[model samples]
Target: MQNQVRQLLVSLQKQLSVTLQSNRETLCHPVAKGDATEDEWLCLLKNHLPNRYQADRAFVIDSEGKLSEQIDIVIYDRQYTPLLYNQNNQIFVPAESVYAILEVKQELDLDKIQYAGKKISSVRNLKRTSAKIVDVGKSVAPRPVTAILGGILTSDSLWNPPFGESFQKAINSLTLSQRVDLGIALLKGSFDVSYTEKNEVQTKIEVGETALLYFFFNLLWRLQRLGTVPAIDYAEYLKVIDELS
Candidate 1:
């Protein structure tokens, strides 16, 4: 079964490659941007990463309720509960349920380390709260959370930059489990997926599946970018998925 699945992946990859090559000219065209804000970029990364990772779901919450809530991404289970907050809040949540929290900073500042630590503390608080709630209510279930910090730096230099340092700090600070399990899809100039081995696998999958899923996710990402869909071919993509299945 593993071999069959791997074979299917390879075959799909070849088909996708051919499709991308045939449509190279069109694909090369600029991916139209919306407002070019950090949030928009984070949203794009979130949507794309999940599809690439075959994740059940991915989401972004701007910490609307809390002062320290600047979480950029929160990956959840298929049920859509919070696994992790990118930034921490005073509210207690489960640490095990949280996959990871990604804090995106555009620049590498020394102060951001302190900022990251503060977020972790808030996350710990949420865990405590979640535990208390669970203890009070027999119906309540426990969940875990993880946290990570990501910095996006764009520069022409090929070597010696704050980008590398910022990334190192984020990775170093995270628990080993979080470092291994978290997804931080950072985009500066083009999209960079070299943060970890898992990210590398995800990038390859995206490239491999581009032909089959391009139009599907292109429309999705574009809609996310535009914040609306002017036109779509929903049935057509569904037909493709059906055929593929």
Candidate 2:
């Protein structure tokens, strides 16, 4: 059973790598290439992740009406907070529903890492309101908001030694609010970061054929640790709308 699972994972990784490499080689327009890359990563997450999670491209909005910069891929809670908007294929998810946000690029580099961090910060900086939940005819106190995971996904890496000192330095340079919790270069490797009790960053990098498996399982473990998102305070949104009238 375990070997079959491993085989399936390996096949998935090969398929993704080939498809993305095709996109990079065939797509001439930069925008088209980027869009295609994002779609591939988004679809991978959507197809593999649990039904409780919804993955898509979206602009996250807070109750205060602040909108985050567009995120390449957003993994949000489908079982808890409601979808705020989806019109003309443009989505706007409530900040409270979001679990993780990722930026998709053709290659991993210092510039791409910095850009991803900024995009992540845009969502993390937003305000989320948590309200009490009614469970089993009883009022339950609101769950505290979980730290939203942030990451960058790419087909390749720019560095000679992909997971060398330069790569570590770039990741370590990010500010607390802009920290990237995970990263994946499909053809190269995957990496995950965690903070120590003293707030120091610890990173684990996996290279070779099992890179995809490492990333997929690590992502699942991290998301599991986050539990469920808090119930959104819809009243806050309603109050804002009322004031606008």
lDDT tens readout by residue for model 1, 1-245: 45664566456545433433344334344332111223343444455554422121223322222222534443223232343333333232223233334443333344554454455444334421122123455644433222322222211113244236554555456442233221222111222222455442222212223322332343234223422111122343345457779
Alpha-carbon local distance difference test for all models: 0.34, 0.93
Residue-level lDDT tens digits of model 2 in 32-87: 99999999998899899999999999999999989999999999998968878899
Candidates in order, TM-scores: namely 0.33, 0.97
Q: Could you tell me the TM-score of candidate 2?
A: 0.97
Separate clash counts for every candidate: 16, 0
Q: Best lDDT goes to which candidate? A: 2
